[model samples]
Target: MKHFATALLCGLTLAWISTVTADQKPNVLIITVDDMSCDSVGAFGCELAETTPTIDALAASGMRFHYAHVQVGNCFPSRNVMFSGRYPHNTGVEGFYQVRDTQYAHLVDAMKDAGYYVAIRGKVTHSTPYQPYAWDQDLTIIDGQKQHIKNADSYYRSTKLGIQSAAEANKPFCINVNVSDPHKPFYAMSSKGQVVKDDNVPSKIFTADEVPIPGFLFDHPDVRKELAHYYSSVRRADDCVAAVLKALHEAGNEKDTVVFFLSDHGMPLPFAKTALWHHSTRTPWIVRWPGVTTAGSVDRQHMISAVDLMPTLLDILDLPAPNAFDGSSFKPLLEGGAQPGRDVVYKVYNENSGGNRSPMRSVETKRFGYIFNPWSDGKRIFKTATQGTMSYRAMRTVASSDPVVAARLQHFNHNVLEEFYDYQADPDALHNLIDDPQYQKEIEELRAEMRRFMVETNDPILAAFDKRHDLAAVSAYVDQVQAESDARRARKRTNKSPQQDDSLFRLVVPKQVQAGQAVLVKIRHTLPKAMAEQQFHVTLKNGDGGRVERIVKTASGDGVLEIEFDVPANLKTKSVVVSAFVGPEYGKHHLHRTKGGIAVTQP
Candidate 1:
């Protein structure tokens, strides 16, 4: 009897210890705001009052990082970097596509493996390979009517459901609540098809006059109007943040949860979102960890990247980080320790949302910023998401009237190859100091640092810097490599079965060819024997002025079609679109179309 009682007591003690250890593990809640700049948050110093009361309160109750940046400025890549703790190049996820390899361990997967219930509430498609990163409870709805967290009520309900589900599972939770506020097509619209005031947006909607304009933009009337709508969206995003935090408290998980609040990237404006400028990659980062992080503490000394988020979270949870991660844990910095030799952060820009190639890389320090624009050969005009906005249209209208605005507009449209900015003196990055002799030494040092980083990371575009003037060659190389990758993926998917194989067709041309020069247009395809000898019509249309050039090409014995055409000497456009079709005579099927255009530079 005595031996049995002793054994029972030991078992009970072990069970109690296990329960305590599980309870000690903190829950994690990440609230991500889309297209929100660091300066827009009230806690980060928005001049406009009440712009972000909820976010401000969160900051005051936690730690705020003043100089945190994302590895890439775009949405998908930035979020991927945060989740994978790797650079875009490393993960092969520079755009909206998923990483071809499933070997990589995701943060949510890691959390789930470590016995935590994981959930993602909004913006489901922003991260790729939905199967590998599948959550225990996915509350994201993509019915086209409302894809993301629509309003405060929906956010509150979704968050509460997530917490409750985790509690029912009897596991600690890690939830990602992506709010799609302030992205585009702002809350309210007017009769003139302009963004106007609406009561449903926010309680205190900012007016055009009350909006604080960034130094990069001209203070035009239309710009202010667009900004007013953006501010209203920002306010709405803040309310969503408040709602999520409220849910955490009401669920009684506030004290045991580590809350993270940040933007995927910067605001969706010119020189901010798609470009490698100051405003492009900077994000507002706030962390609230009860008893671990000091309340109201601010960290301005460390320059952290979105890539570090995964490793840092793992460290905070006392879990081991994967060896594949490029970023190390910044947990020491959060615990009042310094991260030595962490002054500079690197950034990259590949293709935009439209799949247009405008490769850029940069090295940003606390006081200086250097940018390398590989596509800027004086002919390739950079077009991105900002082009569709009303503010850009407004700037174009006033360019002829205002010379300063005209110069700014011209520079924004046609950027030079290299740019250097003293961020301390000019935070807007308006002045290009690359040619300034006073900063020659600084420029060289930054360039060396950038080159070293590229080499260390094995950046595929590092070779393009040497051929900066030859935009066409660089574009061709990138396209060919991507085509080969796609073909390999397709081959694997079809298991090399000829009957099931639909040939991959890619139009390969130099991104930028000199006017009046003979350019080779290669149609690379993997057609089966049945379609190998089929003839196709190839059309090259000027993107700027819509000049068309057509030619009939017969596929060679090995399924390769090569043709040469003289680029029109008097071509008014800077880029050309190459497309092919196998039509009514062969079959009612389209061959393939180039995702983007080929550049045509001046001779």
Candidate 2:
């Protein structure tokens, strides 16, 4: 722990080469929202009754990049690409925040290296890694908790202070204010309305009947109401966006600032949050540039993805984009020059919240979207999506009357299918072109593209699963899991069913995560078999005495699990040894694949 900190601290002098003299370089302000769609804003032709005068003005004040799409739609993946300047597929990270990539060069480190004051408000996945990279100071832990509050004002105030502090210190500034408020179960509404302890209450609740359903999701009046509430959250987010723009202008830095507003993925729901489908991975991107971009102009014909943020930002700043960034620069499009199509925009989907699994890969272009279905099971990829958002009462109501609904609800508890789509003709992607004979030529072409992508990216999953087809190899592997399963049962295990043989586990600790806050560990698993009958446990140890343990038993087949806990003040520093174990009584099998020490952040 001390070694990495010393390493970072020792290198502070070399981290930056002051460029304050470059008056032409624009100040950068990136604001990312969660679970939002391109169609929600008035500028995007939103048919809803939401008020987004702030965002509309942002579009009007600077340039609006209409074709601005995110790299990967899921929260973690989207932010990974944005901050690291690497494609999500290439970074080898998917849904959930557990997957850790410590080797990559984060934007904070790079910007600081180039003589910029990097102050981040709000949240950017990996921005404030519980572990450290290059932030100058830490915030006051809100409510005496080890964690800082994820608030909208915190972001704005932090940015304002960082900018002021930087100028006072005579340094160029690059600030990122991340707001997790308008995210799920919007928490930012208290200022505008009566405060509620539960985050589930809607800030601007609306009935489902009021929402114009996107074609991708099945129509239900409740779904429409949910959509309405979702738009309300977007409006709340716009308010903060307006505030940030105002601050930039008031500081006489608005014209000098390069602002970007986007979401990690679509809204959280059946077709929205967890898929590689157009709705899942696509985003509404509005980049407000003072000089480089022309105002009120849209770029529909140009296809852009989230992975491009890093490289594009560097390009706009007239700096060299790192070779490590997988995306190409589209500053040309932003400049109103010749618009060329990206050869391919790659995307991947992994574990959903609470460990539900549905994985797929996509290769999208201006005219086509070729999907890869490595798992061609009997069900649809998005069938179980609605279950996540449905309440227990709502699910029980349907379960008693309709067996089909009962069955779907049951399937929703499991994982299945991989799909392909033709986004051009079927822009909404209602019809999947995977098995259609008419599109064989297109299918083959897409297959080649997918294959080449896997080869180039060197994805470990594809590399390991290439031709290993058979239930037997996995079946035997299950026997090992069964031994552990039986031991767990002996210890009063309630979870039962076949256990998955393949699950990639990693331990993540934040740099600034206090000595008292619980550590959150994320795991990605594939249940070639079910595990309703068994329980799993992950444990962490530091040499001998100080240790932590977590138990997880999921009702679903495939998914990810996050276990958070508080650490003792005695266990100070920023690193710890973590191990994953399953079963009971003399542990028949243990996964010790990683002897690696997890990282911790020292704020």
Candidate 3:
């Protein structure tokens, strides 16, 4: 993706250098990491045992901003805003939609036009091309099991490759190494707590008790174990960061290069990665500008977003900040001077198509967070998130009888009230104060403030955002595309004996079913040509309630089982089971008829 199709010259030759301020042009380096939260760093008051020496060293040399945030909470949208210097809505990519270049030039193009040898080393935004015209070179990567760039070194190598090319051209370079660390499967490179692949991967997993599993989770042991696994990945990320800095030092660019280190967004846990809440969207920004920003300085006063970064770099380099940017330049603050920044920085999301869920947009300040849900009314229909290998998703595979965690999972899936948080009293945002009488004034104030931001930024949400199905519709449509992809794969597999197969039984709901409506369960057997007809009992049970019973099972076709019954009128969300116990239950695969995430909305 890094080969430029053609060169766009800003004509920054040493001869042309006489036309610009000679002392102001500084080389820029942007390093972005994956799902990392404030909890992993010591600077954020996280009590971690391992040393984050590289990140700590970087912070010690420059400034760390405690209140830095992202324009959106999710990865694709955050990258969109970061690249365009605009809001996610304005970029026409509320979530993972393609970025339209006509609306905004990428930061690389802008910086390149200003005569900088700009090159991208890691996951470049898909909204733009990996063509030669866009970047000087893109370095190849060895993907981790989870299919993202593994660590800072994965990116550093790419950047190093780009640096070699830049040297051949006699160019001063602006390099961006987009690192992927600290994201998930939660556990690093393995299923168990063991590090199977890279010896660099952390071996010991963190537990919820070890790291404060953000309150949004049920505060359960399982969730804590998940948190520990996530922190283990963070420890490995720190080591990777150390490797990158060492490369810069070895290359003799440590002092001259302006190194900016940060994650695109927060963690991949509940209410963190995809949501617009502070824990998800807030970025941990640390910049080391050798002679400019003071060493070991922590700035908590200013509110800055990733979108503000490009313009800030432009300003500090004595380049004109593009008028199209929605963010203000913060060169003064970076240069060791102080000026008043915004009281608030707005964040939003159209949807998280990856998680197969709803749309959410949140506005946050030092003290408050207000989310606008376009699907709060529950009238929307979306694809079930549990369609794949995600454990949280696979758990829904047997939601019936798994009431506690299932309901919590569904609460997130279905989402809750129009979210409003008092960061002061409910920093973890456990209790939503959106409709609370005591917080009415605060909610209204935030609403008005967000409205002004929308107007000023020409946000498309200003027109589309409502107490309707805006977010759900957009996300579901994308899910429809994904579902089709899954469908294609599903069709290819010949299920000769799915009944006797090792994997559990699977079923499909052809259409939406509602409360008190008739639900039909159809099961098929994939047997070798002769072993088609098999006797199997189909059972139905409410996964959440204690009720368990067999549904109508008048054994039918040579390779099929079908059951139809009137669903309970009062049931809001429930799963049906079709398990057949053969030979005293020593060996039998559990076949499940799962719900297809349909909301039977009240009139």
Candidate 4:
């Protein structure tokens, strides 16, 4: 017998390549959560009770949605639009730099080029070019003296060592996890600082009269003691999503995993994190995908985002989603079918997380929402970090004895340039309806569908929202498109020069400043040609913690410096962090470091 039929045809071709790589790959997981709040769970209508029994048993074994949003309501450009399925004006990443265009293809580099095994854990600096999501087990600990894992027995031992290293690399994994429990400095203490507690963080806390508040805030008692410490940090992010789905059912890969669960936006309060408001870019998506979603289903007729989560997980792993993805493929609303042009849901709010700009734009629809703002002119004061919380200082101390908390703290400090709202009769967007008259034909059909989706998304603020009905030609076309986009990003940072022992500073100023106004900081640099006329120094610092200022200058000879300053006529700071340098001790040659917030307001 010719060597017994060539060793039984090499053992039937290695058992048909291990049964077609274990029945064509599956395991993904995801999880996410930071800042949370899409009605904080319990199958989304969370009016308290067990505040999210493991995200309502992962939305009772998955497929929740009900209008999922988040294109950008902060958090590293809404997680770089869920790993670059694109948007933040096509991933120039409207905030947080570092994605140096590897020609868009990320969902963990297409699930690590199809073989899978990616990993990750906490925020991990909102995932940037780590060699195309090169994370085979990261466990992110965003600096707080590391040994992280704020409960649920170290999130079930870091999701059972990332499912035993993707089941010992037999592959088919993805992981992610990122659950920094209900964001904002909430709970988690230990290394002798205290607060942590036991049985996976539950010594039952949530009190401030049993929480709830939010109808866009102001229920006082310091907004129910910060919604009882944000519902105990959303019950420690639903016990790290039931310890990563009980480490995917003790690594038997919970019936070939898929998971998902969401939230990377909303609830870090004050009209929800950096406001695009409908509880700030909605969220709580949920999913599951075991025999393709249908467990306790809900969908609510298509309206997705977070840039359709990397083409619906590359159309549920059958892969191939690249035509430079501006997101498509809801995988027919995840197989329960019905996508039909997926009606409305668009939002944006450029530069926040203190790199202040405040732009804002919106669209919504499933009974209108609208918005627009463009830094609402009445002296721009929308400072962030939820305006130093405790429910915005208990609604600015009962805003002069409450006229509905002084018109909701004057629409959270000055805002009103078209707002609209109806959200099926005010879903907490407490009445703006852009000058009512029964919503002037749904505000001209949502301002012509937000100017045809900002001129089909080429939106660099679509020529200042197409000169918003002439506010002096939208402030002279937004100051000539921000001085030709800052002289084309200062001639692409002076033709990228730097590195003979580097040096290329930059301070530039004015994104809004008022208190007696004077401004003009500039400072730019490029040195190294023998430190070209060095002298520097700068400083500034007020980012609402007031007083710092300093000055010094010099650099000219093709190294620029400028400087003007003034502003301080009782400046009570709202922003202005700057900082610069060139040796001789002031942060000894530190150069530049601004990263947003120059606002200042109140003249």
TM-score of each: 0.75, 0.67, 0.68, 0.31
List CA RMSD, all candidates. Answer: 18.1, 14.0, 19.8, 26.2
Per residue, candidate 1 scores C-alpha lDDT tens digits across 171-220 of 98999999888787676955233755655556457889989999999898
Q: In candidate 3, how many Å is residue 434 off?
A: 1.4
Query: In terms of lDDT, which candidate is stronger, 1 or 4?
Result: 1
The CA-based lDDT of model 3 is what? 0.60
lDDT of 4 by residue, 1-603 (tens): 223223322321221111124357877788888888888777889898876666776676557888888877878888877887777777766655444655677777677888887877776666653322556556442111133655655666667766765766678788788877777666643322234544445434687898878777756666686677678878877766666666566666666677787898888878888888788888889877777667677988778888888788878778787656666778776668897877787888776644555667898967678888766777768877788777787678878787987888888788777788877778888888687687798799888998888877678777777778767665565455445445645665575534323346666777787777677778667766665567777766554222256787666345667877777666443566666666554323435454346677785
Ranking by lDDT: 1, 4, 3, 2
Candidate 1 TM-score, C-alpha based: 0.75
How many clashing residue pairs are found in candidate 3? 18
**Which regions of candidate 1 are displaced past 4 Å?**
1-23, 129-132, 142-148, 190-193, 196-200, 466-603
Query: In terms of lDDT, which candidate is strongest?
Result: 1
lDDT of 1: 0.75
> Which portions of model 2 miss their true places by more than 4 Å?
1-24, 95-101, 124-130, 137-155, 187-208, 339-343, 353-357, 373-386, 391-418, 463-603
Report, for every candidate in turn, its global Cα lDDT versus the true structure: 0.75, 0.57, 0.60, 0.70
**Which pairs clash inside model 1?**
471-512, 472-510, 472-511, 472-512
lDDT of 2 by residue, 362-407 (tens): 7776656775433334443433333445332344466688775566
Q: Ranking by TM-score, best first?
A: 1, 3, 2, 4
